[model samples]
Target: MRTLETIIIGAGPCGIRTAIILKEAGVDVVVIEGAAPGGKINIAPRVDNYPGYKMISGPDLAAEFFSWLNDAGVEMIGDLVTSLTKEDDLFIVQCEHNTYKAKSVLIASGTKEKKLALPKEDKFFTRGISYCALCDGHFHKGQDVLVIGGGNTALKEAIFMADIAAHIYLIHRRNEFRGSNKYVKELNDLPNTTILTPYIPVELIGGDRLTGVKIQNVETKEERVLDVQGVFPLVGQIPNSTYVKIPGVLDQWGTIPVENKTKKTQVPGLFAGGDILPRDIRQIYLAEVDGKMAAKAILAYLEK
Candidate 1:
């Protein structure tokens, strides 16, 4: 029943940054992470938007962040958090193997990729369908693949697979893309890329493994199937805030609504930031800023 000043529930950009700041301030704080330290950034193939480096890989950036945590003497606990509850102004964090009590808590768990929810999607999980192009693109060399979504992730993955896969079929529910114009232009110029707009995936067609995807045009209600060996669905992200047991703190999407200035949630001593907060843009720097702000806010709250 050891209680600390603060506990962060993630090790991503936001969590890492928040932990560093709190540690430097001499606050008793610990970060809990279930997966790798870098979080979703580890899955990214390339990151060209971060402030410091003009171009760098996601893993590289994450490694640098880990180094900072080490140098700052921030303690990180590796465990999967199951739930969060508050009792008598103290927060209780429940994990599979252990439990922790903290005076304050920060939820920076980030987001997970949204699934198409079509039947057979689970059956072909690793057989052919994948969410990470950098991890599975090599397996589809000289083969055809389907990329579903209309965001930057979909565009980037499509471009990355173009070199390995013989052909890339990118399908989106809308005719217009939600990604940057630069990515759209680059993806269009690729000789092996074909853009299918206004199409929604209706079913995943395969036997033992995925072989193709059945899509329908949103406008015409016409249906067609694309023959491919891989399916990358980068449709969107869903907040990883199920551990938050507090009612009225979560929105319809499960994302926590926080005060823009301080990242404070509806409950006192409970803060949220980074990808868990509803925002149009999701980036490492923005998440870092959220962490810094939340840490500072926590410090101020602790002072009182």
Candidate 2:
């Protein structure tokens, strides 16, 4: 049972950035990650927004981030944090493998993809229905696939699958997409992509594996079935803050409410950053900023 100065959950961009800043300031900090170091950024195909690089793939950016972390001598542990409990002045973080005690904690677990609550969705999670097009798009190469949603993620997934899948059926509940104009234009330019607007998914038609989907037109209430081997639903995401249950801290959306400047939550020693915070815009740059602010606040608290 090694007691640490601070424990940051999730080694995504937010956690990684926090670790670098704290380590540079001579703070004892450790980052706990469940999966890979990149988090959700790995699922993205292209990222043109982050400063410095005009256009770079998500994996490449993630690699650079990891390289910086290594050079900074930041410690990262690969483990899934199950829960966080406060015992007197110290916070206890319980993971599947071990438990850790820390004076302060930063929650940067990010968000998980939201799923379509259609029938049999759980039965075919890995069988044919998927959320990440980059991860499962190769499996549906040269075959018809369906992409649901109208956000940036959905459009990106459709565009990435366009090259792999023989035909891409993009279904959206609204006629207009919420993604950027560039992505919408790019998706429209692809001859292999078919845009279906004002349509909602009714049911998932398959047994063990997904074979097709049943959708209905929102206007005329017309129902139709699209034959596809794979389905990628990129609707939205839910914050990963259920593990840290603090009364009166979480809002209605389950996001931790934090002061924008300091990233401090209602609880004194607890802070939050990244997608887990109740920020309108969730981006890599903003998450990095939040991490830096959290690290500064923690360092000040430790000094006091």
Candidate 3:
């Protein structure tokens, strides 16, 4: 088994940033990512939000990050972390082919994009359907689109769509929205927003790409189809925290329960960063800020 001073369990922006900081501080750190260094960045269309880079493609941004990683002399092991075992106050990281020992672990896996249940969704993804409004919304400007789910993310997406799209059809299975009332009122006030409550998507119709969405009313069982070239799924997100099983600080959803101001998790040496923990805002900038703060806490833990 290889031994290291610290093991970063993700290759996303957060993980890479943390590794850069630790290495610059003269700390021995190795980044272990399940996939490539830029986990979700590989699929992101274009990220215009991340500061310093005015406009950049996902792969381009990822490439730039890898360049910095190289300069920092950070060791990257592109392997999936299956599980973590605590042995004598150290963490044993179990991957597919290798096992690593580290004094501390930081989970920056972030939130995986939520999927649409439609079996055809997999086949049509990136062709017309998208889960990220900030990434794909501009492509459908002045065009009709369908927004599914009723949570805060969904409502916020609908609000975003209303800004550029000519029209939007908001569909939800519940008559009452699952998102906060304040945002729901804002969505309702939009002129182009059409609320289709108590309805759920049944199928996506299109020839080569998504042309429309088929929805049915749960109460009346009535069927209706909305014509559109784009479909956005803005439902809630699921955290990637199943690898570690530390006790006394987890909610039912496996998210680390931490104090609002401090990013301390249940375990002493273990900490979480990015959108993995539950919070009102999960923006890219916020996640990056949280990752930096979490790294500070981790550094503090190592000192004591």
Using lDDT as the measure, which candidate wins?
1
Most accurate candidate by TM-score: 1
lDDT of 3: 0.79
The residue-by-residue lDDT of candidate 3 on 238-284, one tens digit each, is 77877775556457876666654446676767766777777756656
Clashing pairs in 2: none
TM-score between model 2 and native: 0.97
- Per-residue lDDT tens digits of candidate 1, residues 129-209? 998998888999999999999888889889989999999999999989989999999999999999998999998998999
Model 1 spans > 4 angstroms off: none
- How close to the true structure is residue 211 of candidate 2, measured as C-alpha lDDT? 92
Q: List candidate 2 stretches off by more than 4 Å.
A: none
The local distance difference test score of model 2 is: 0.89
User: Worst lDDT window (10 residues) for model 1?
Assistant: 43-52
* Clash pairs (backbone) in predicted model 1: none
Q: What is the C-alpha RMSD of each candidate to the true structure, in Å?
A: 1.0, 1.1, 5.2
Residue 45's C-alpha lDDT in candidate 1? 78
Candidate 3: Cα lDDT at 83? 84
lDDT (10s digit) by residue, model 2, range 13-44: 88999999999999899999998887788888
